[model samples]
Target chain A: MSYFSDIYKGIKTLLTGMSVTGKYFLTSRKGAITQQYPDNRATLKMFDRFRGEVIMPHNENNEHRCTGCQKCEIICPNGTIEIIWDRGIDEETGKKKKKIDQFVYHLSMCTMCALCIDVCPTDAIIWGQNFENSVYDRTKLTRVLNEPESKLMPGVED
Target chain B: MALREKNNKPNSLKTNNLELGTQNMKPETINSNFKSEEYQINMGPQHPATHGVLNLLLTIDGETIKKVEPDLGYIHRSIEKMCERDSYQQIVHLTDRMDYLSSNINNEAVCLAVENALELEIPERVKVIRTIIGELTRISSHCLWWGVMGMDVGALSTFFYGFRDREMLNDIFEETCGARLTMNYNVPGGLMLDIHPNFVKRVKKFVTHFKTKIPEYDRLLTENVIFQKRTKGVGVLSKEDAISFGVSGPVARASGYSCDVRKYHPYSALDKVTFNESLKTEGDTFARYQVRIQELWESLSIVEQLIDNIPEGEYRVKTNAVIKLPKGEFFQKVETARGEFCVYIISTGTKSPYRLKFRSPGFSNLSVLNHIAVGGKIGDLVAILATLDLVIPDIDR
Candidate 1:
């Protein structure tokens, strides 16, 4: 009867499925794809595009491209960037101009969107490939991107 | 005296009710026995089988589900309200949280909406790359679902196999976009960046690798008698019911609905690619499973077409710093891994949208749960839910 044929077909199909799994099971240790995370930490490497944290690159002379335009601050969906700038005398032109006092970034609020980096006119900020960003305290995640004594790079003001 | 009688009317009605209750109780008092009641159970805002923070209020009579009421809003973040406050550019990132498995497609839907409003001409390269990545996203989403579906049906190894392949795709996404799960790579104009140098090579290798692995997938679960017994002819959603419930994606296709957004409304490089939209007439849990499986092959074919032929041009168009849509209504729909994901934006000539609505596929697919699962056994409900492949955040949002 058709009923018996159906029953026979079901068993055949099940065995087919089991055979596939069985092949993998027999393959065993060599087929294992899992990376022993912490144990393999020494060999792990992150990609160049990984959006870990916003960092401001500085030259050997400690001059940076950041002119404190506050573009990043405005473009940020969340209030993740706080640009506190004050008017200071320009060294080359001997004229008053806006200079960055602090380029504050909150890691906790950052979505790793890289939107701020994309919109930055001066190419001052970049995503640093440091994925381990966990912190014990919330305040510890906030940081001033520029060095303590870094100044705006010459010709960036224009 | 009239007012007093009106007030006493309530007392007399209460006395009549008490007399009737005593009369009914007299029969019960003579024949004292316990009666069984339908059992109620809360599946979860925390249950693993729920796939996310989804609560199913199930009324069961001895393991058969009498009713299913989905309790939503556990993961609701008011994303639409948030969109009203955020600029069009910033809104792209928020969509990544909904139907996170198909984040790329979600991002593309929003981007397409804004681009259509502006009448922007996206470069050919952008179109090709977008199509490639979109197919990749579909394959990855299906891979994850296939594994999860297997697990849901009591075959656990499929989970590992599915994730193993999925990790490859995630690596490819991470290499190019920087984020693995919530890849906010699509801007209004085009992609956030060009594909990674190894993107093409890696994708080619993945295609070859996955092609061979699909048979293993079949062997491990698809043909399994136990899986078939559990799934076949269970939770059948007829074409009429499917359409009435507004179910889309594989769920609709399984019921023989030719409603593939990519097929009907070709966007990006979808028109360029040659692929079949997987369809079935059964409309059961197994049919839904087969539809997604067939779609995986089709998605791979779509990617293979565009991956090599990615035109060389600018990755993104130079849009203005502040993107303001014209004061009008704009709508765009894209075929996500699940189904039709639509973004409707009402602009008041401002940087931010006046109102935004995301017509997510999971919401409609989820609506059919009660319709299909009510008469099924409690165990069969899990298989039905698995086939539905609901992403609760998309529903809640």
Candidate 2:
């Protein structure tokens, strides 16, 4: 009786597990859910919150918001940021507004961390959701986010 | 000779092992027992349960492990040296590659270390986001562990379930941070970006769904009588052994050692979050399971508590992009789902770190195998190894 009982118990246990898998494979709602990645690219939505690459954007008055405080430059643990300052007199309150002659961002060495953008006082920089950061040349990653000739405000938010 | 043999109950029937708490009876004759040469066994660098690239020289007599030595340096990526070449902000992303499974925790640990060194203040919004992401990482890591642990016990279906649930979190992470496994979201002062518009609602839905599925996992693996039989008393790591081995996180707490970094030393608003350290005193495979399952519930609760209350503030601290750390060494530890993982940084006061060392939990957990595997059957060895949840690259790195 003991030998027959042991064998029966083992078989019962085995079937119990198989039944769970069978349940999932047959009837679970999520069983049919599969992400067809490459083919589904058309309907795939890349979220706006993604922090991919840094870009210095300008707004009305053709003004740049960066004051060249260099907070983003100092907080970066790696030496991936480069900034050149252009000093000019402002007509608003007769105060000097520092504009960036060129703001260089090296994407190859950038860890895609949003720290620099976090520390920027003015919303001068924002991470561009560009996943195609690959380049044949390393120098191509060193982009001037702010052009020297773009009409820029000293420290005002563009 | 009779008195000496009478007092000691030998662990094995044939082995002449006289070493116990003490040889109680005075030996009338000492020359009767002869020591034999030890046998050699190879473990890892590729073994399924070696938990990465760790190769251990296990000297054994039959199944009893005698002398065990861990051979390291197989997956050594000179991240510390590489940090010195980059800026302060750039190094935060590299930390993600250390423990690829719990990438958020890895990034936070390194970022916090750099922040402490520079004395950078983080915003309120970033803190809540960090906590949410950290808990999500913990849940994902535990999901992987649960599946692997089930596979160790010869239960295959749970692995599919574990991966099925965890993939959803990976999707969320990929949408938010651009990568699934190595998320470089943490910075010196705060998070890369604020939580997504629908992050809170989606997280709530995920938690609601996850809770409903917990009982299914229990029915599939935890409540099984065979799993209980194999794990209840096998590989019992006592409270004392856990301390001496420097084991932390769930591995140490499972053995009744209350050593949680989040509790003892809270970092990144961990104290503000309401959560209890999951514990069990058995120090065996079953105890480990109990700690992890309880932890999953606690992590879900932590996420449930803070997802909505996230205050609106700046997502990062105001800092420069090309940064330098003051001349000093910065060391920090974070509790990954596995255990305590330490990142040691030697700063030459430059943009990149001078020397960095990652003291990972899997490395130490895998080292204790020879002590536990002795006397247990080979089949139990798989159970023991799977219970440890060894990740090869983590061990290799």
Candidate 3:
């Protein structure tokens, strides 16, 4: 620990630290990995594995696969959900069945835990990668999935 | 005289060094206390080095600090109030937003608290997985601290290098839980999802890659003479003082206090694992640096040991499809990178908690400022504050 050695160590240490900055500043050649998010969503890829918002899918007859079973409602920990059933008459089958009437969810209240997707037995509801979920008003967050009612039970394989 | 300069100028808070200068006081200030002529200075309401809006009033004369007064409640978001408004499962997300840097731990803490309240039994496999992820969060948090602490002393390059490996940790986190900063991955009783297939392999790579880089970190920042000179004996809080002030984590360990929640009170699967707690006898700024630098290796070793041993089972416990907890008060204390965090929940036998309160580590860490920063040089103030690694939101909460 001589004085001269200490000076040299300080200079050497400084150079070593600067080199890290130099390395990063010079290495902008590294690939452009950032997706530029919302600006380029039309061109960018979205993985199915991406944990996005939850959505209920529909069958070929435009009938929602959500059976008013409340499986998703049960699995959701936040209770950012409310499900209502409506009695609907099937045109072909000519019988009344419980159908999903209102599927309400609050995005602001959502933690995106993804439990609702896992609990849905029919795979009727899936997590969608529409990540541009920012909204100005909390009221707009409460949503109902509007699927057509005409094609309900025209034909069924189940 | 420094007293003349203080009398001539009024306080405006536009200095790299935050100080509260000499002021008149009665001769006898305490009965048993030997510390003399302590002046107080507040560091924040808007100080960048305080890390997030902490207010500290420091007492000083010349270059040695005598008293540091920390005033908090700037960034508090009423997070617990919002939590009680949501259901048991909903509180998990709230935890993520509270401690943005250690979001995983936040998620895990809230979830663990909920499970404790509900008497929910988590699978053994879930506990082990929680332990591994929790340690990874610790590594990332420490890495960021090292870099910023260096920058606080005007060494900017360490900041970038710290983020270099930290970026890898974030990527690993991103792949597992989607969001980078606020990943609410842990839920009550278990994780939100099963561990991804490549998780073990990615972790194995990090263990080898990060171990090699430790020497590089030492060479880059820790070994420097200037750093050692700037930190040694500055802001030295003795073990007795640390315990009185309730300082935990590296701050308390640096002072020889047995305060790490991980070692004394193990949560998750930390009890099953063996890891050394890094300690220093000096209780100075320099000692805190050493404690953190030494702990990196220990944390990495824990990750290495647990990566292969993760049990095969459901990631989270299978609860009543929707979770509802019995009415009672539940309290949980888990180790954050900075110190011990206490999460308190009061339930009225409802879907949501009746009330929630988070006893964040930064509150206690920030509280000790007034005692340490008096009579110290302007240069050492940043160093002492950096050692505490204060996060603003936690303080406000």
What's model 1's overall lDDT? 0.91
The 10-residue segment of model 1 chain B with minimum total lDDT is B1-10
lDDT of 1 at B279: 94
Q: Please provide, for model 2 over B238-337, each residue's C-alpha lDDT reduced to its tens digit, 9 standing for 90 to 100.
A: 9998888877778789899998888888787688888898989999989988898999999999888888798887998766655677888888988887
Docking class of 1: medium
Candidates 1 onward: DockQ, in order: 0.63, 0.21, 0.32
- For model 1, report the TM-score of its A chain: 0.87
Q: Give the TM-score of candidate 1.
A: 0.92
Itemize residue pairs with steric clashes in candidate 1. Answer: A14-B225, A17-B219
For all predicted structures, in order, the TM-scores are: 0.92, 0.74, 0.80
Chain B TM-score for all candidates, comma-separated:
0.92, 0.85, 0.86
Best model number under lDDT: 1
The model with the greater lDDT, 1 or 2, is 1
Q: What C-alpha lDDT, on a 0 to 100 scale, does residue B221 get in candidate 2? A: 78
Instruction: Sort the candidates on lDDT, descending order.
Output: 1, 2, 3
